[model samples]
Target: MPEAIQFVPYVLVVLLTGIPTWKLLVRVGLSPAWAILCLIPAGFIIVLWLIAYRRWPLLEE
Candidate 1:
């Protein structure tokens, strides 16, 4: 096995989680800029998501 292959799973996980996170954020008042904070490399995304969801009302179903 190659070293790069080992990271493939982690990379896939980021994309998988990122997509839905972005969609959920976009559903609320946050702009795409804020929603895409999930792409950042730290707890910033999780904290932002939590705050945003807590602050904004649900936009739709």
Candidate 2:
């Protein structure tokens, strides 16, 4: 496989994960900048844990 082709899947995966992370953080009243953590090592795990267990301060009535 071409070296350049190998990067395509990686880029796609980032996009796939980033968009949802951004939206989820926003929905829960967190800063969208938190989504960038998804691109860092072990950050995705932290984000998932936060999303699963943290209480959202902006819950709609």
Candidate 3:
């Protein structure tokens, strides 16, 4: 039980950031699953690069 309590804050952070990031990724024409990268070290930088280099679906349409 004590061990499980330790994870609560981590889980909350993931949920808080991941949910909004997932939505934004979808809106930007990237896969929502990419939001998981935000939880990783320097992963947000990767996602930013992906958005910067890739063509947006909205723009293509």
User: Which predicted model would earn the best TM-score?
Assistant: 2
Local distance difference test, candidate 3: 0.83
Candidate 1 lDDT, 1-61, residue by residue in tens: 6998999987787687677666766766565555455555674467465755575675343
- Candidates 1 and 2 compared: the better one by TM-score is 2
Q: For residue 52, what is the lDDT in candidate 1?
A: 58
Q: Rank the candidate models, highest lDDT first.
A: 2, 3, 1
TM accuracy, model 2: 0.78
Give stretches of model 1 more than 4 Å off: 35-53, 58-61
lDDT string, candidate 3, 1-61, tens digits? 9999999998888788778878878888888889889898588778778777888788898
**Which candidate do you rate higher for lDDT, 2 or 3?**
2
Clashing pairs in 3: none
How far does residue 29 in candidate 3 sit from its true spot (Å)? 0.6
lDDT over C-alpha atoms for residue 22 of model 3: 84
Give the least accurate 10-residue stretch of model 2, judged by summed lDDT. Answer: 52-61
RMSD of 1: 3.8
Tell me which of candidates 1 and 3 scores higher on lDDT.
3
| Candidate 2 global lDDT | 0.84
Q: Which of the predicted structures, 1 or 2, would earn the higher lDDT when compared with the native? A: 2
